[model samples]
Each structure stands twice: as C-alpha cells, then as structure tokens.
Target: MRFMVMVKATGYFEAGIRAGKEHSAAKDAFLHDLQDAGVFQSAEELLPSSSGLRVVFPPGGGAPAMQAGPFLPEQEWIADYTVIDVDTEDEALKWVLRMPLPPGQGEHVIEVRRLASGTACALDARAQTMKADLQDQLSLLHP
Candidate 1:
C-alpha cells in the first residue's frame, strides 16, 4: 500500500525554531532511519502559510488570479510529508505512527491508499501520443 503521510504543524513547531535544538536532532535522525529502511519514497518540509499562493480562475473566461498567502479559516498547518510504499495500509499506518514529531507539538495525519496500476492499453496509447507530440515540438524548434 502507498501512503502519503502528512505532518501537520502546530504552534510549537514554529516555537521549536525559537525553543532550541533538542527535538531537531531527533527529528533529523528519525527521517534518516526511514530512508535507511528503504521505506521512504520522498519527504519535503513546507514553508509557513504566509509564503504560499492561492490561485483561482474567474467565473467566466478571465485569466486565473493569484492571491498571496494565509487564506481564510486557518486550520491545521501542513508542515511536511513522506510518501511511502509499504506492504499494506496497516503497515503504512504503522510506519507513519512511528514518525517522530516535535514532542507534543504537532499532529500527524496519515492517508493510506492502495496503489492502482492503470490499464496497460491506456498507458501505451498515452505514451504513443506523448512521443508524437514531443517529435512535433522538436521539429518545430529545429526547423
């Protein structure tokens, strides 16, 4: 099963940067262990909400508009994530449960989903179409 484990940030996470270095070392080591176990596919830590952008399209045919950070109804902050491929949902959850978080600081949200292998015919057709498109683009660029 493939699971996208999301680490929800709390106030303490920001506080940690100011609080000191106790949890930082443990957090880094825990991430390393996950990589060593061959269970870690990818991980990324996001910036504060104020740095994000929200894009929305107009009701008619107007172009999309972008708004700067901190959208309304502030809820749980998404801090980081780890995508892991495990044996089962249970296993994925187990892995997520073991992830280290700033002590009493943040919430860990684990979303597990069974990976799907799409129809071979569909994939093959898409690949062929992409190849044709790429060739056309290359010809246009070169010619």
Candidate 2:
C-alpha cells in the first residue's frame, strides 16, 4: 500500500522554523532506513501558508477566484510530507512513530492518508468520457 505521511503545521512551522540537530539526525536515520527498505518515494517540505494561495471554485460551474494566504488557525496546513509505498498500514505507522517532531509545541499532529491511484477513483463510462474531454481541452491550451 502507498501512504502519505503528513506533518501538520504549527506556529513554528508557519514561521519557517524546524527541529534541532538531534531531531534532524534522528530523522535522517529514519529516512535512511525507509530508503534501505525501498519504501521511500519522495519527501518534501512545503512553504508556509503565508506564502501560498488558494483557488476557490464557486458552485454551479461559476468562475474560480484566487485568494492569497496567511490563512488563519494554522491547524489546517501541512508543513512537510513523505510518500512511501509500504506493505501495510502497520508498517507505515511504525515508520511514522520514528519521525521526530519539533519540541515545545504544546500539541503536535501527524496525519496518514491513503491516496487513490489512476485519477483517484474508479471511473464509470461517463466519467471516463468527461476525463478525456477535459484532457482534450487542456491539450488545446498547451498545443
């Protein structure tokens, strides 16, 4: 199974602060283990929400609007993530437990999510036709 392990953003994360050297070393070792096990696919850190943007799509096929961020309450943001192709959820959890967090954050959260492959869902005939049409439209934009 493939899983994405997400490190939730805290205030420090939004401020672009990271954990200490000891934590980093431990994390490095943990990443090395995951790589050696051949489960590691990619790891990345996201910029703070303050530096990001949101695209809001209105109801009933209305035009989308763009909004800049520094969005509130921090908890809704992700700071970093790792994608792994592991054997089971249990194995993924074990790896997650080994990841170190920035100390003194009061409360820290990590989330694990299973991603859907092949356009994220099983497509019916109509859905497949919709996808092809969407792609055809996009190709017109690019080509």
The candidate that achieves the highest TM-score relative to the unseen native structure: 2
Model 2 deviation from the true structure expressed as Cα RMSD, one decimal place: 9.0
For all candidates, what are the clash counts? 0, 0
Error of 1 at 35 (Å): 2.0
The lDDT per prediction is: 0.67, 0.84
Candidate 2 displacement at residue 79 in angstroms: 0.1
- Provide the TM-score for each candidate, comma-separated: 0.64, 0.77
Worst 10 residues of 1 by lDDT: 115-124
Per-residue accuracy of model 1 over 1-143 as CA lDDT, tens digit each: 45678776556553335324766676678778888887766678787666778788888779999988664435566777777767777888777667766555435454455546442232345678999999999999999
Please give the distance, in angstroms, between residue 105's alpha carbon in candidate 2 and its true position after superposition.
Answer: 2.1
Candidate 2 lowest-lDDT run of ten: 116-125
lDDT of 1: 0.67
Q: lDDT (0-100) at residue 96 of candidate 1?
A: 67
Clashing pairs in 2: none
Judged by whole-model lDDT over C-alpha atoms, candidate 2 comes out at 0.84
